[model samples]
Target: RDLHNRGGERFIYNLRAEPATPEFELHGKYYYAQLAPGTRMIWFVNLSRQNGFTGPVELKVEGLPEGVTATPVTIPSGLTRAAVILSAKTGAKIDARLVRLYGKAVYSDATGKPRDLVRYAHVTCELQVSGGSQARRPINTQIVGVTNPLDIVEFEATPSKITLRPGEKVEIKVRVKRNKEFTGPIQLAMPFLYGNSIIADQLPPGVTMSSDSKARLTGKTVEGTIVLEAATGDSAPKPLERFPIAVMGRISMSFSISTNYASNPIHLTILGADSKAAR
Candidate 1:
């Protein structure tokens, strides 16, 4: 990871970390996640293999500040990336800290005996009381603090579930309940995008939001519609059961940074053109 100190000077600590033997390196981007109490963020992990090393790696995060927790990840052999979900509890303490990312695996030694090996990486985390503020820290450290809850407290999609056929179109209504502390406008969407680039999308392939959607929720406006259109013929997604999706409320902090809150997941089912539901 490339990191900068509080003074803005950029450097990497591992420039001289050359290993003399065949091994794998655990690494990931310097992630800056600012989360509030009761919110969560997804952190990504990466791996680099050297000297013909090919083994499954078990990954985990350590040194998380109080009130913040993360689930461990496992990168299978031949895979380069994995993700960990970090969540904060309600009434969590306001704090920040640097966390450690470690990976372990078993390899056969020259004597054909299984040997345990481990590697390390660093990540930064922060929990802030407000959004859109710049908080600086040393490399390989994370910050966790408490911020105000998002304007969207909770939301639900009407219909609760969906069953549609190929070439059919439907609309899902999202009703957002505000936090009362935040009265600003909020954009309700199904896909999370960063500056015209898709970051994470919740919709399944062949089922897309329509172009003419009015999904902006302003003051006193709590209801919005998301029109989903299924593809026709061969382009239609194959019959699938119980696809989970949710609505995301986005508040942009900058060109590349934003805070997103998600609603409950709803199930969607797609049927073939000539298929019929069982009685």
Candidate 2:
């Protein structure tokens, strides 16, 4: 450069590192619903990653009105989507408003230091009136309210809890009580979703849902069994470990959409292979 400048010629060189951040975005068909008293609605959220982010994302709903509650859910690592279920109390009053849906995750930055990152859903959500099936109008805010009768009034799992040895297989009977208006077929399964490809079971490592159990309820049928088996070998969770599992009842809204309702959680305890059940 000095030689070139002396000869009336000029040149320049710039050096810098590529810029990046540990972050991601949340995407989904926003929580657009008018839940009624004694009803539930499920919101599905997918992740759009950036900067090579990889980890489970913890989800929360903010600005929900009184008498309405959201289930605690986490999008497992390597999975792209997770369901957020909102339930209204049997006596919830009429209310409506815009709400926020966001996700939080932890990742190590380029310096190897852990950092917390948060992101919100990119699109607006609309909370329509019950049975309001009309052409959608574009909007800019997320909405959810409590107002009309809906499906899946009550869903419960028998025994409430379970205890078993490694390699033991147990049966959990789930009963769905729905409003008189909804008598169509419903599918019951675990809550974990791997995009639209499959519905994965959310259980401890080595524990799995048995294929022999029935998962579909057609017509007047309201009860189904979910059998879980624990592996006897290395895959089983350690003795004394406990895991919480819920039965999810899904009603298809379309070929790609569904409304899911959850049952009361069941506490599952793993017993030692040669030992008696823990008290």
The candidate that wins on lDDT is 2
lDDT, candidates in the order shown: 0.66, 0.71
Q: Which stretches of candidate 1 lie over 4 Å from their true place?
A: 1-22, 122-138, 148-178, 183-193, 198-250, 260-279
The RMSD of every model to the true structure, in order and in angstroms, is: 7.7, 10.6
Tens digits of per-residue lDDT for model 1 on 87-198? 6777777777656768888888777889888877644433243554445443555444446665555566777688778788888888877777776777776665555655
Candidate 2 per-residue C-alpha lDDT over 220-271 given as tens digits, one digit per residue, 9 for 90 to 100: 8889998888888777655533344577777887654567677766766778
In model 1, how large is the Cα lDDT of residue 19? 44
Residue 246 deviation, candidate 1, in Å?
A: 10
Q: For model 2, where is the 10-residue window of minimal lDDT?
A: 1-10
TM-score of each: 0.54, 0.61
